[model samples]
Target: MMADNLMQSPENWTESQVSTWLRTLCVKEQYIKKLFEEEVNGLVLLTLDEDSLMTKIGMKFGPTHMIIQKRNELFNSKQNSQQNAKPTRSKKTKLQQKNNSKSLHCLASSEVPSGQVHARDKCASEESQTPQQPCILTSKENCKPRPFDQEGIDLIYVKHRVLQPESGAFDLISPCHEFKSFAIAAELDRTRLQAKFAKEVLKFATGCMNIRSNGTIHFGVMDSKEDTGYVHGEVVGIPVKDKDIYVDALDDIEKCFSTDKEHARHCVRPPRFIEVMDRESTAKNYVVEVDIVPSVYILKGKVHAVLLPNFNEAANKVQYEKKAILRRVGSKTEPVSDSDLSDFFQRVKERDAQREEAEKTLVLSTPFCQDLGRKLTMLITSGKKFIENDKWFIFITNKFKPDDLSNIEWLLNMKILSVFDFDPDSKISGLCSKYLEHHAANMHSLQSYSKSSDRSIKGFTEKLHLFEQTSWLFCNGRSGFKANETPCDEMTWIKTRMTLLMVYVSLICKHILPKGSLQVIFLLTSPVEKPLLHTFYGFFTEMQGHTDIICICESETNFQRWQSFAEEICGTETVNNFSVVGMKMSHINATMQMIQPVKACAKKHLPVFVKGTCLLETNREEHMASLEILTVAKKHLPVFVKGTCLLETNREEHMASLEILTVNHCDDTSKDFINEEKANIEQQFYRGGRVTWMNFWLAEHKYVGEVIERDAYQDVSKLLMDVLKFPL
Candidate 1:
């Protein structure tokens, strides 16, 4: 019986016989296990070719080819034996009866798995007993169980075949409304795995990471359109030969992310690829489902970004690298925009602030903080005095030609006085004459008086009193030159005005007003022609020591010229007690409001100037000098000073000190930085130690306050006045 069984055809062998034969062929245990799991009997085994062994049975090529070779050899031997002997009718009938009995016995055996009983019974039926019956392995009842469970299989079937556009399911495999965490692709690039398909994979994967969810990408299935204009997903499985390419593409994508140290968390585990059989097709067609896991190590206060290779379509290769931060919006993956990125950072900042608040408690009674409070209080007080009592002399030099009267009118019509809330009719005496001839009598008297011995200190004082009543002095070059006068005459007239102004300031500082008490501001709208550069240079050189001059130039050229003249007068690149700022005429009101009156006493110490958006100090001497100004400004003001003994230290200690000072300062109703109209500013500062820094903007007005050392304080009085006086 054993000899006869060994010589029997492979299709006639039972399940136990087939397993023994595969073992004799040295088939791997895993392959044998797959055969058992699929309930493969002699009939099913004979039907499987090399493609079925690899794709359907999930075996590698080497073992699959080996099994196919053995099966072919068995068929050849059986064919040769059949040709060599013609069976008689009596012998054939008896042989067929024995085979039929063995087939029925095999179907009734307990060793056959449950689902395979149907196939075994069909094989034993009388219809299959014909001598010329062909094997039918493509029958629906003979199909192997799918790798996915019932639920998974149902999902894939719906996605692959259903198209309900009104319910948000579309035929396209693109990002859509139906699926937020699922995507589908038909195939990969045949030539290279990582061309366009790799990018799509990465984008979908990262989009899933940002949305904080796992996602799926089904390859070998695509959205197909019917002639009726309806679209639905179709299971167009990858070709047998190209399946390896698609597998490699998925592997490459996994390797690309796993190797990246920065974004490796996005793929904590390698993607899972499962081969699924096509439900509607009888052919050995299959689709691949890739499962992606969400990122495991997302950082706080940062948006996760992934690096993707930039594919050059024209060159048909990857040319460079780019970074992307993607998030799923509905069904589409979108790169984060600049505004969204900014808002994310802002939220991060606020979150960090909240965390810090929860960690550390702020105390307001520290010595350093008390010192800051005292300084802040003094600044507020001295600032008010400076704005109210200090005398300001604004000298305007208009060098516009006679033909350019429009420029002069523009200057006169500027809201310069309005910036300070000064009424032109009362606070400012006059606009000053446009013509130098209008000031000819005063100029003649000034020239004669300067040369006369009778020009005593008392006489100069009276003259200055009259000049002080006229808070603003306008010098028009157009007026200085007559129609008959040449350009040279105009230059001479300017020089005269410049000289007279300097002499008048010198007299005032020398005898009448206290030295270093007056503030002088120069608004030079018109350019100082090159011809009069030297004369203007000499005038500035003499005026440099007596006053603190702030020159606001309306044009770049004028600013540069004024800056050059200032540098020349000081004999170095650094200019002291002088500042040159350039701006458009339209910004004059805003610029003037930023200009604080420089105290004459602190001129040597305050050598810092603001140029454009930069605040520059010459050296350590200037930095210390500014602190000294603050010290003096505080002393002159009537305010309660506390904690005078705190020692200056590093930033941490300084901040601790400021917290106490802010609390103390906030207690005083008269010295509150925030008023009822600006209550939000108070809340912003008091919430945390946010007011540690010196420079801040309140109600669109900039205020600068600094505490360099225990004894040295910045003159925030001047800055505070400038800030508080500005209209919100």
Candidate 2:
């Protein structure tokens, strides 16, 4: 009787009721999110299992996805009630088709082109007969959309954005209430865009887990509800496995939009959005097509990883040790600075402060500054750091100019491959196995920074160039883990580990970035938390451009603080204080080797580094490059040293984007030291074939850290008073 009177029916229900209902089921609410409405089919079948079996919970399906799909069916089915209402196409005359071909032939001779055809010739081919196909995939026959594949989903991915943090300031009416296309400006609202993004991320994540439970895989879509309105989210697969079996539709999008993208700053053509807004125009429609796929990162299984230059086969291990631990939320540990993390947030805070500053500074730049406001969107989208360096790990390299290689000593001895075109991990690994005689995870280091004119440093730098294309992923399947919970919820697997590590390292002043380094904050609530805001904003609040990147990202947009930091490091603008993660893995997808060496606590009286021998060599030409690579590695210096190191920065012009610097003070006085050094450097700088180091490292096994018997951490600090070593 209660179901009969109230109107939650699809035809009469509003967005508010739906959003409120969805909130109650999530947050470990016992059952996965579902919806219900029965009168239409008498029994609204909630396709719980892929078998299409129906189970009626109430007047409507209890799950939101089923409810939304039903809503879409009802609306779309009603809208297209009259399938017979078709329009015939205007046939092109044989003479016109022939004339078109003849004109192309005539034009090839560099003659004046044939007279212009009627503008009407550009009408959509649909003006003639057409068969039904997937909607929006193609622009049209007449549009001849420049081979633009209809990645309608690609439109959903927004580029990175600079978030602002201000309590009660710049806060919106909830993103769901205003969420809309961040890419399409004509119909976009800033506050709405951010809200929509938050809602969708949450929805997509929850829906993805739900779908996986039924033993069925899905590609791109889920459903959401918020204060502003309803949203059908873009869903893709999570990598529980290392294959692209699920989310294949996204693959289609990626195919159309080549993965390689540039910032296209100051381009003359209108934003691709302008063309999309003019979707009716054939010429513009051709320009508006794009893929709407999101980049997918999966956390599954125990993958192996190997280090370079040195190794400890038996000591190798991962940062985290269990899958249950990897997935556990709040079942783990606490963050070092929750109050500080929230209060010290920087992305949103800095953005807000900068926006205020920009508002104040606008008068200074006049026309130039005026143009900046519109570019807010552009900067957010394309302002990514140049990280095309392989993914999955931090890859340090010596970025030398094309002509400047080959004179270095290492280059002279090594028969290098095309430095730009080989896999550093594979080549390095193969070389190490065959020639270095060292197993994976057993890399050696030089005893001293400058045993011979710092030439070895230069050689190492040049060789890093050869490794520019190398790929790697970090972690011991036992130790490394990630998750998709809130940044504040450090209790989640990934967050807890990062938080603990950040705290542990930040405790020391030598650490690159200190704890609570951030001073801005932004918190996005799920529709379940704030249904009123989501119901009104609807799809606008569920966009991907506004989503955070540090957590689970279901879209292609790279909108996060880490991405922001990377962009600044890689941007064309001058960087006074260049900072980036220092790790050996980046790109190239190399398997992980255990980080076993530092796992167990060593004798307190003598740090293991004191016992390990240091192997040193010199190559004059690439010495500078080598120093720079070393600087990046310094970030993790204390790890092997129980988190301690003599810190310095690379000031050289050609730092290869990796922050490393070699100690400049060294004496290798062998005869024509200076002259021989320069000549030797010039001789083998190029074609270093750094990949051969895998073999070269075989004979190398050395380690360097202050002797543990003394308090080196404090001693290094006292020594720091003097001019620090050459920040190679």
Candidate 3:
């Protein structure tokens, strides 16, 4: 009724006054000046009502309400000013005023009764001098009133009764910028401001068990892609009917989370649902935000589509149809790809393999174990020979538990040690234990001797120790030891003597060289000694010998048998020997020496026979005592010797200049003796293929005839005739 009585012409109002009025109406500041300019130029009119103002100027609901209140106050004040005095107007304003008045009169005549209009005018005139306050009170309570303006207009507070104020208006609300993990929906029913989708939203919300990290999802504000995953989606504003509607929205959202099956198990704290108003806008609208407590573990399952805004296909324009699994990728939430999942699985597999390998590694905790490990590494890296010798060295591993064998396979495969891990419960186990004890004993003895800095250990005790160490190999016989009560059986005595000799050699050489470098010789007398020979062969072969092995046999059969055994065990065929001796071989001193140091005889182990032949007369004394036969064949001599012999045409001085003697084949059987001089040198007197004149040259020296035979000359002469058969 008051709006009908009030009238106003805004043409005379200054831009600043209009701007101040528009600001109170909550119109944006930038738009107020623009609107004012257009209004003054007649392109726009200020007479429009609240609804029309929103449609044309795009003002929000709150601003439109304020604009309506200000308009009525402006017309009321105009009425008070009109009764006092009328202001002069320009021609443009006057014309505009006439058109506006006609429009107003037409509206009043058709819409209102004459009596009501007159009464309204009377009331307006009476109250004109006394400015009336604008009543913005609801039926429940009258608002706090402000004083009237000088123009008899009420100064109502433009901002009144905010239905949903800023988020700060709520006491228990979380900060706007703070991240609280939860699911939030701005409007369940935008018009009614009800959380209609609350139940559905809660299902997709990363539950306390699933929410491994701090984050949030909010709806209602403008869906901003610019918001870092802090607030997943945007909410422009959700229109609410009133504050009560907002309370209902909160209740709906909170109840859904409270009823969730996973929420209680995963959530550390009770989920909170609160009403947060859009501070960026002045509308009676708010966001229904629910904060769900996070869990330490990630939910490794599918999430409901309705809970995720991006997955809501009907409402959202997302790539995924009904469901989308969104994961945090750095600062953004993105879907996981199949390739990434596969790569993650691959990494997990690799990690498991590495863990297994680490568990299997040998633990070098003790000093002995550490030292052994270092030595094994060195041996494996050195070459095959060291590793082969140490293979049987598994005897040292008697102390190793059965479980240690499992981890030791890796070391064995790397050739760090040789081992035959057959039955752990076999008789070999006892042997291994004995070997270990022996090894420890030897190592301890060596260490003790070193520490004492003494070389005076008695040879007899050493020899006794050596015998006792090997006595375990025999069944009952103390091979080389003699006792008065067990007075000498012949075989036992020989066995005992041989055993003693073997130990003696080993002990004496122990100081001068490593056991592997010494060459061992054993006398072969009888067939029963073969087994004993085998035992000795195995022991020495395991030590890795540096030189040829020797065996003095009393019979050819024994020698051949020994040679066969040597070839089988040592993988070599080269063997030489002296004539069999029937005399007691034990009388000879069992000496050990390097063969290259002794020089006495010339015996070449050449390929003279069709298959195999020994270098005859290898014994130094035997070779010198026997007759010397100079046998030469085609290509048999060295190139240097052949070169010198081929130049022996005038052999008088040159033949004597040569260190090696030569023999000439005599075909003529001549009885003439030639004395060659420089003036009359008879080089053709003795002409034949290069050979040694054994008998003819023997006549020159009395002792030489004893060593060279006449048959040796004939044999050479015939060998030369056969060589000349091939055409030169």
In order, what lDDT does every prediction score? 0.41, 0.23, 0.34
List runs of model 2 lying over 4 Å from the truth. Answer: 1-44, 48-437, 440-728
The model with the greatest TM-score is: 1
Q: Clashing pairs in model 1?
A: 171-231, 171-232, 364-660, 369-657, 369-661, 436-479, 605-625
Of 2 and 3, which scores higher on lDDT?
3
Residues 354-375, candidate 3, lDDT per residue (tens digit)? 3334334524343321222222
Candidate 3 Cα outliers beyond 4 Å, as residue runs: 1-204, 207-211, 217-288, 297-321, 338-728
Better of 1 and 2 by TM-score: 1
**Residue-level lDDT for 58 in candidate 3:** 62
lDDT of 2: 0.23
* TM-score for candidate 2: 0.19
How high is each candidate's TM-score? 0.24, 0.19, 0.20
**Clashes per model (N, Cα, C within 3 A):** 7, 140, 13
> Residues 1-728, candidate 2, lDDT per residue (tens digit)?
32333233333443334434333223112222323232222123211221132224322112333233333333333234333344343454343343233211101111111221221123225223222222222111111111112222222111111111101112111111112222221122333322333222222222221111101111221112211121222211111121122122122221221222111111111112211211111111111211111111121111111111111235542121121110001211112244544332333344334434533443432222122211211222233322111211211122222222211221122222111111123223322223232112222111111123454534743543423322111110111113311122212323223333223112221222222221111111111111111211221122212221111111222122222222322331211112211211210011010111211111112113543323233333246554532211212122221212223233333455754422222222244554444343333433352222212222231221222233354776867855455322
lDDT comparing candidate 1 with the true structure: 0.41
Off by over 4 Å in 1: 1-388, 394-396, 399-451, 463-468, 471-505, 530-547, 571-573, 591-728
